[model samples]
Target chain A: MASKFETPQVRKFPIIPKLENSATSHLSPFKSKEEFQSSLGYPGELVENWQEKAIDKMGDLLGKYRSLRVYLDSCIQCGACTDKCHYYQGTKDPNNMPVGRQNLMRSVYRRYFTLPGKYFPKLVGAKDLTKEVLDDWYSYYHQCSQCRRCAVFCPIGIDTAEISMAAREVMDSIGVGQKYCNEIIGKVHKIGNNLGLPEPALADTLEGLEEDVLDDTEIDVKFPLDVKDSEVLLVTPSADFFAEPHVDGLIGYAKVFHQAGISWTLSSHASEAANFGMFIGSYDNMKKLAMRIREAALELNVKRIVFGECGHAWRVAYSFLNTLAGPFDFLDPRYPVPQHICEITNGLIDQNVLNFDKSANDDMTLTYHDSCNVARASSMGGIMGGQFTIPRKIIQTVANNFYDMDDETIKEKTYCCGGGGGLLTDDLMELRVKGALPRMEALKHLIEEKGVTHMAAICAICKSQFSKVFQYYDLELDQIVSLHQLVSNALIMNKKEV
Target chain B: MSFVTILYAAMFYFAAAILFIGLAYRVYEYAKIPAPLKIPTPPAPMTQKGVAIRIFREVVFFESLFSATKWTWLFSWIFHLALLLAAFRHLKYFTDPVWFWVSFELVQVAGHYAAYLMLAGLLGLLARRVFVDRVRYISSPSDYLILVLIIAIAGSGLMMKWFPSDILAIKLFFVGLLTFNFSELPSDVVLLIHLSLVIALMIIFPYSKLLHAPGLFFSPTRNQVDNARSKRHVANWAKRMESTK
Candidate 1:
């Protein structure tokens, strides 16, 4: 589907645009149909008493999630985070601002729950839960990627991501579901992966990948599936099996395992590392998805679990997995119960066991884009800022030339790929293009000044999103490469002595 | 007691009750709610002591805000620090014999001058709220009014320096209110207006955005330690789901 909206022009330097009301109001994604919603255990359409149901859901979430409750009350309108959101910067929509988006729900929270808003709504800027307010919530909440960048800047640590998640959860409860997220979540529940790839298809895809690796490197690298008693169970996003640059990353993971001589297998039961449950703010759904990994680990008797390159998926796996589905005391306790592939590869690099042919990646100058979730919401190697460092350490060791983008744009303050938090569908192509502006400006400057050739990222969404949005900025689609894709290029594989 | 004294005394008690009780309830709610996940914003502290230091920096230095925008940080830090000093200086009214530190020559001098800095900071913040396009867009009526209310309180309190209210009588009235004994409050117009505004602020503190003071400490993103993988963190409500599984 072609976008009716114009792509926001990338500026020389990223500057905060003036306030524009309702700028992205008409940019909402397609709503989930009855089947999609019902599959997720939500109503088929808008509930008859959606207003009351939404309010009740909000109250329930306020009691349940501490982030939502404290964040709603903590914002002092200090505007520290006013210019921190990528959507706001790109779209120039006031409602896209973290605080502006939060206020849409905050106003309703005040009206129904707080004293001042209850008696004096106008004075506090609280509003009644009318059709227009709900519409605004549907439109603006989807705009936020739940990136958590604003929380880093906020004086009180009031995360708009938390509020946006809660808002999404409330919408889901009221039979108002986003087609992209809800549909993906339902597919995960039904088919064990976001792509809905059944057991035989997943095995066939792995077999094909094995033959491709053999054809290229002439190494009998195996992509085993459901292999019992494997030492490691490799869980990755379904896109890794289907999409470009992403599938290349999956091949990289396979090659690493092949070199390290570690027994690893992909489970057909829990094939996806990307948990859309977190995007919808459904605890039950999130836990259900996580439990699949736990069950797969137990069923296969894998001693360790390693997650592949996915941004939000890493956050769920690293931060929420322990709480959601844990007591992994059943597995080996020597390593982090659920480790990242980067952690594994970095560990092997530290041990000096993996050799690299750095000249293989000399064709391009590379810089890494710190995917938002991995940078701010998750960690690697049990160290502070390890997520940013470990990936770069790998790139430098495996490749010849490397440069970082602007200091502010690279680390904890990294921009979202614009397609995260379940807004990656084609209907939202315009938003994805505009939201890529901040990142594109920095990347373009690096390319022109430093003579950079390719930008590598660890996230599946970042890979896909940049591949699509790069064309609009006059950059080549191939400029976006996977972190492990670089690794695959430079990795020196030793052939089996058969 | 005269009607003026009685009315003012009643208002003070009422405002104080709301301030303390309402704040206590809010704090209790915050404390009781379980943070189901470890969501400390990274590069976060890995240890409990490290988390303590992180929160300390956030509270004392406005560390996050400082990194975000220097102007907002400057105004906000100035206002908050000055407000602390001014609040400490006002404690002399309630203390029968002021604590030695409160009356220390440097503190007494600095505390008296803090009022000016506080006013300046408030004005800077107010100007941003009214002038900055992004800030102005997010500001509600109450946001501006909250600043105006505090400015008025500070202004009238400063006015007493020129108008010369009976300080001894005012102190006695506050002390009387603290105790069971009742006394007449000096009815200086500036003093009366200042006290009334102070009372209004106290009444609205918990119900208003001022809850940010306590809310900051309770924020999971700032207060949580980054050891999610090392230990299992399950809340009571979430634990129920585990049992069912």
Candidate 2:
């Protein structure tokens, strides 16, 4: 859906002035269908006493996560995080400000849990949990991409992502789940991936990819599926099987594996890497989905697991996989139990195992968009700042011309793709476009100043987002390419076979 | 002791009890609650030593705030540093023989200037809330009220400092309270107002956002190491779930 507000043209990415309630408060995603909600073991519909249930969930959460409890109590409202949110920067909605969005629940929290809010609600800005308040929670929490950019700047380290996740979890407990997240989570539960592509369909897609690779390179290449006794299990996003430039990334992964001569297989059982449970902030769901990869690894007897290019998926796989589904003692200890493709690629490059004809990608001048989750949540190569380096190192090795966007927007302080944190659904398209404004502005400057023609991203969500949102900012759709797409182009296949 | 002395003594005891007990409970709750995952915002340090260094820089220098916005960093650091010095100066009243540092004239002079600096910093913060659009939008009455309360406390304390009070009597009053012996409080208007505001601040410190004093240490984002892959950190509840599995 086109943004209802006037979209700004690209020129130094226009800073939106505060318009005092500029963003309409009522813009919300469609509710989850009853079947979708129940599939994840949540209530099938809004419970009889949803308010009480929601409050009970909040209480349960407060007891569980120290981050939630302390963050609720710790905010001094010093306003360091006020302008940090991309949604707030784009929409100028006061409610979108990290603190303002947090206050939606904090106000209600104060009313019920704190003495001042109980005795002097008006003085403390506390309010009861009304239907309108719940509506506000749904609308605003969805607007957040859970990027954690605000947390980096917050003096007290209050993460708005934590608050937003907690809010979504509370909403789900009351049967008010978002259709995008909960539905995909259900797909992940039943089918192996988010697309709900059944086993036969997944096998067909992989076979088609192999045929395409052979046709292009004129050499023998394999995309093995569910092959037991493989050395590595490649758990990648299902989008890589269907969507471009994501599929191009998948081809790149295949080439890297081929060049390195590593025996790797994709499992039809755990065919997906993107975990939607993280988006909805459900630990049980997250853990349940993570268990699939472990199952797939054991069933296939694979020694190592490697995640392909998806932003938040890498975060879950890198940061939480061991905790959720671990003790992967069966896997090869020579490598990390789960390694990022970039890290593996970087390692191969370091060892001179792969070769790239840099001139092959000479047509495109490129810059990299550091996907928020990968930039801020996950690392590469067991080092600090490897997340920033590994992908860039891969790009520079394969691509001739490369320029970074603004230094501020490149590293740990990177902006979200506006479509992350499960806001990738078509229903939240308006919010996505607006949220993308900051990153797009940085990209615009790179295009103008450095003549950069393409922006390569590692995350599937980021690639899809930039492809869609670029048109709004007067940039062509093809300007967004997968980081591995660059690698695929420059990858020189075995001349002897050809 | 007169009726006023007894009432003042009771007020001090009440405020002290609330402040200590409330803070104790909040901090206890924070310590007891488990962080279920390792979510240190990257590019965070990977080692425990690195995390300690990071937190030390965050606390002592306000490094994150400095990088985010210099104006905020300046104002907040000024207020915090000055408040720390002023609080240190007040140690003279509680200690049997004032600590050597507090007894020094140099430190006393710094404490004197700190009150004025604290007031200026509070005003700058208050003005930002009034003018900065984004910050203004997020400002609630309590946000403004908290600043105003601290400002009043500093302002009243300055008045007593500028126009001298019955220092011996006030010191004796605090010492008496500390040692559990009742004593008559000084009969100075500015001193009384300052004491009342200080008491009010102490009572509200635990309930209000002042909990940030303790909460920052417990914040997982700031305090956690970036070694999630190397070490699997599952909370107690999560481990229990794993057991069932």
Candidate 3:
């Protein structure tokens, strides 16, 4: 026998499967290529022979190639990352392995982008871009959640998630994106948010929520809709108005505002906060999605804008909001001074504006889950929200057993909930579960070993992912609640609970 | 011993110290990313039982390479193992009695094989970098310098062993350099080249990405526990609700 492993290797990875979707399909499983092109602000059709697009534009394409090549060429394939992947850890498949995952993207990228392709293609294991390779690209790229957990272990400072994102961008450009992502983008274009709920319905929902709050607590909270000349325009993910954990989070927001007595309105036009453009990797879609919030805010003439506790929403708001929205007439140059709800709570806490009856949130050991997008991608730069101490301060008063996971479990290198991007849709459940294994495995230890009773989260999708994990592993879903709900549960407001 | 030897040795030693110190500091800094940003996993799954097998397959068997292109893996595996063994076997410098053990005999044999592997691997690696157009573009002057330094170290060390140079004097020079002193290398041109190259690699290891040796573990992605699901990732509003209610 030549070797024993080779036989198994053949049986392991089957030949590349044929592609299901094509370039000509309408309403592309991703948005139709034309719609996608429109979003990218590109004039021509989505790149057909994308390899040709690399011609004469070495600067841009080369920039991507350099990022990929640097990452791949530097990695030693040490398998230091075999068990490190959330997916790999969840399902010990070699294919789900991070190094192999990166190699899939990098090897292909190298074949097309690098100079060796022109001569020694086979030497580099590069081949023609057949339909099979395209299918492989889609399956493997989608398999990745772009959580960046794998990037943390990459030896040469490589980032596989960046590679996956870039691949998704390329796929979206080529009209090969997933249905959930594309359909959501279409919804954002048509109805101002991916959920496809219109302004009237959103207004109706908010009104109902206000009524419910008054009925339950006897508090007169104004669910502001299209209020012109308001000082602040507050926006949140649609999940806040509808979903379980996040709905309570919205209640807490209203409570904070009621206590602070700040003038704010929720624009019925642009209340949704989830941005699918980030998933598909289109700047145009990203801009268009963000622009909806801006136009709605401007139409209502709000002085400031505050984003709810969604991770990527605040990221877009903080990073690209100013550039995309533009020079507004009434904007304070600092047009939308984006503020996190925690910072808002922390402000109240710091100023002693709010009182707490901590016993109301009793019988649970609560710990904080730093949503990866918010902590690593955005904040890690400065203090409070610019890298704040506020979240920790807020967590202290919430529950008793505030045990940390481990030294490496807390910051900078936090793992994503695999459902990031548009993967939270029910269609990608298996992948999400598989990808969530690492985080769940860690949580399992905390619950069993570290006495972690309640898992506190800020993002809506994080709630979604955590709930699924809780159910899958038969852990407590009710044990998971947003920090806002916990705060609202125990908020020592001067008025009585109605 | 000439002044040039002493001066060159001093510069090499200083460069090596700077490289080691800089590399250690950089790795520590990378390791210190704040808590909220951490993506911690439960624990390493690649523990002693399973990892020993994996390490053997990767390091001892080079099994991955057997499937890898013949030229590529053959050359690479040979080079890496050789270098590894030689480095480990070289404990003879510090511990004189190291040569007497059974493991030492195996190491000596492994050492010879490693020397051969080193020269061949270096040639193959360098040739691939030079001739392969893609690798060529990524390759820089510093990359080539490190490769050349490695070759020089191997080549000169081989000369000392095979030609039987007065190793005591040469080892004394290295010891002196280690102890904040420098003397002329007590050997001829081949040995001189080896001594200088060893010192040069130590110096260059820090500034270049080659320092990825330790940098890998410090990577937050690999070492961290994926405890994202366990903690209450509450928003500011939630915190207020929890505290106030």
Which candidate leads in DockQ?
A: 1
B237: Cα error in model 1, Å: 1.0
lDDT for model 3 comes to 0.60
Candidate with the greatest TM-score versus the true structure: 1
List per-candidate RMSD values in Å.
1.1, 1.5, 13.3
Residue lDDT tens for model 2, B101-212: 8999988888889999999899999998898887777777888988999999999988875778877778889999988876788777788788888889999999899999
Give stretches of model 2 more than 4 Å off: A1-4, A11-16, A495-498, B243-245
- Provide the TM-score for each candidate, comma-separated: 0.99, 0.98, 0.65
The lDDT per prediction is 0.92, 0.88, 0.60
- Which runs in model 3 stand beyond 4 Å of their true positions? A1-60, A63-82, A122-127, A326-336, A384-388, A496-498, B1-245
Output DockQ, candidate 3. Answer: 0.05
Sequence-dependent TM-score of model 3 = 0.65
The positional error of residue A489 in candidate 2, measured at the CA in angstroms, is 1.6
lDDT of 3 at A367: 72
lDDT of 2 by residue, A177-271 (tens): 89989988898888889999999988898889888888888767789999999988999998888887899999999988887889999998899
lDDT for A78 in candidate 2 is: 80
lDDT of 3 by residue, A1-498 (tens): 111111011112222122222211111122345554455444334466755543323224334233432454345543334444555544444445666666655556546654544455554444555666656667666666666555544333356665666666766555466766776677767777767889888888888989998897778777787889877788888888888888888988888887887778887678677777766655557767777787887798877777888877766565445444533445554432556677677777878888888777777787777776676545421242333346666877655457666444455456667677566766556566656655665666778777778888878888877877567666777777888988888876656432
Model 3 iRMS (Å) reads 12.9
